[model samples]
Target: MKYKVCGRLGKNLKAGWLALVLSVLPAFVVADEPPEDPAHAHDPANVWFIGRGGQLYDSWMATTMAEKPWGNHPAYPAIGNKRGYPTWRCKECHGWDYKGKDGAYRYGAHRTDIKGVRGVLGMEPAEIQKIIMNETHAFTEDQLPHSAVEMLSYFLSFEQIDMDKYIDRRTKKALGDFDEGAHAYQSVCALCHGYDGKKINFASQKYPSYVGSVCARNPWQALHKIRYGQPGTGMVALSNVDLGIVVDILSYCQTLPEE
Candidate 1:
């Protein structure tokens, strides 16, 4: 009689364990719920805003800190060396692509070693704009005008671009070609850079050499300058020119002497 009871009890125990497992099945099913997609994902409206913002920022960078570093105003000092608004241009730090030193300046003197905002894709817009106004980003809260700050912040908050894929380091060549680039340069850059592509003394005490100096040293920088127009100086953006024209200009400029 005892032996018979043991066999029956074992079967009952197995059945009880199975029932317990089945009872919690709903929890396991719920745990498998899908994870949330990135905040920027799938929404074309958001994409448009971010893209437009990015273009504006890049265009502004092209104007302010692009290659010249001292655009629109002759009196302004170098970006990193200066202590004012002209230096506060975003291109001075985060770069045209918003990648900062992590981007175009990864190895140059301007290199900041900072990460890109593109990395923080899901961050709140306010938080992103704050970063731009912060010392770590633009670093000119006091210098920047309220309207400038607000407008720049609005663009920065929405603008986000991944530039790592676009720029190349080894060849020092930007994303585009340098052949057609010559045409655009001739139209605008030729005046300053010169016909020989050996004009402008970027290193001189008074002015910078536009020739091969900047392009050879920093292609991405050259691209930014060409696209955005040097900050604090009279250099305005030639966005109308094809980016390929920029590359050609750089390629041709490289033939000039570094000294």
Candidate 2:
């Protein structure tokens, strides 16, 4: 009887020790989690780095909540439509397609006629950082912290996708299964975008551009937003999911309301 009691006590102690170890492990394991503050949430995960980097590349001001610069960037050409805050964005000059003059933004309100950053795709991050910090680019430390720049460099180096492969630039259609995409969207996206995806009107009540309009007009931009999230918004980046799934979501979004 005493031996059985001791055996039971041994099992209890073992279980108790296991529980204690399990409780303490998460704190150590999750130490690398991004901070609660949005500005400081530079995640270390490879996919998260890509997401944050993409957001920063999209709009550093929106990503870091940094104050807008006073005037047009010194490097910004007089021919460029974007001035001041907008010009500061990496994409303003480079194009969402990452091809700059060679890609989608070659001629539009967003055009700068500048060469895109696609050349830097396989380049070293340090070299890219130097280019961003140099006099030609001239991004100041106050406007963008080194950490933020690191994210940008990481993104520019690794995050760009050949959007043309997945989207038909002419027809502006996604090369994905609408039926499979519907399931993914209804399950994952409907919470914010709604069943019809008219929950948020991006343009305004008059024009009333919703997910469909944006996706149809610019599937490349929409895919980027889907994978990295919208800046200054609570939109969650779908980085951890499969690329196929992301494209599928884009296909479904294309079917939503435009106006």
Candidate 3:
């Protein structure tokens, strides 16, 4: 679908997160925040907790460079369809929407009765960290280091967004300002992604997953990568910026060349 600034999201449909996030940005340029010194984690610019945390959620194996777990996850149901490494991914059971059976994975091949991570949206990071290391989750010290778990917990506590609040579940469209979106992309993303967003092919030679292609297909996943840097790749992140700016970037991305 062709991207438009004032499309299906409607002028009256501005999300509160957009305004809320913009408030945190330094003159609307989140990337221009404080220097990369050994700063605190809460600092938006220094923080990779959100990005790396979410990346670990997407695939701990890739982000940690750890071996992908073989066979089904112990918690994964026997009735589920997938096998091997993929089943161990947090998104496999909980879903890209973080709403597991209750969300987009409710009825697909990825479907499982397992609940989503949304339950811990506002919980303390320490509490969530325990849950990750708990027997039910069964992540041992050897598998996931303390730092990795801490980052993942921080992401669960403060960084996760209610994607439904931003993108239309049906149309997968986002509300954004054209000029703002263009400026945001050119100022930051264009350096790596290049103008037209064709600098990289993330998927494969046959499918050719370019920036536009990803946004076009599974925008929820695209938004996740946009907010949190790509798994194990130094892809720039807007994890600390508000959801509005990122969605604006996404709306612009939808217009890129998919091939």
| Highest lDDT scorer | 2
RMSD, one per candidate, in order: 12.3, 13.2, 12.1
lDDT tens digits, residue span 9-83, model 1: 889988998999998896666432212334442265544333334333544444323333333333222444435
Predicted structure with the largest TM-score when compared to the true one? 2
Tens digits of per-residue lDDT for model 2, 80-183: 87766788888888888788888888788887888988788656788889988889888889888998888887777666777777888888889998998999
In angstroms, the error of model 2 at 83 is 3.1
- Give lDDT tens digits, candidate 3, residues 138-239: 767866999888888877766676778777888877666557788898898988988988888887888787888988777888888888878778787787
Q: Which residue pairs come into collision in candidate 3?
A: 21-242
lDDT score, candidate 3, position 220: 80
Flag regions of model 2 displaced more than 4 Å: 1-44
Error of 1 at 43 (Å): 22
Give candidate 3's error at residue 165 in angstroms.
1.1
Pairs with steric clashes in candidate 2:
none
TM-score of each: 0.54, 0.80, 0.78
lDDT of 2 at 25: 100
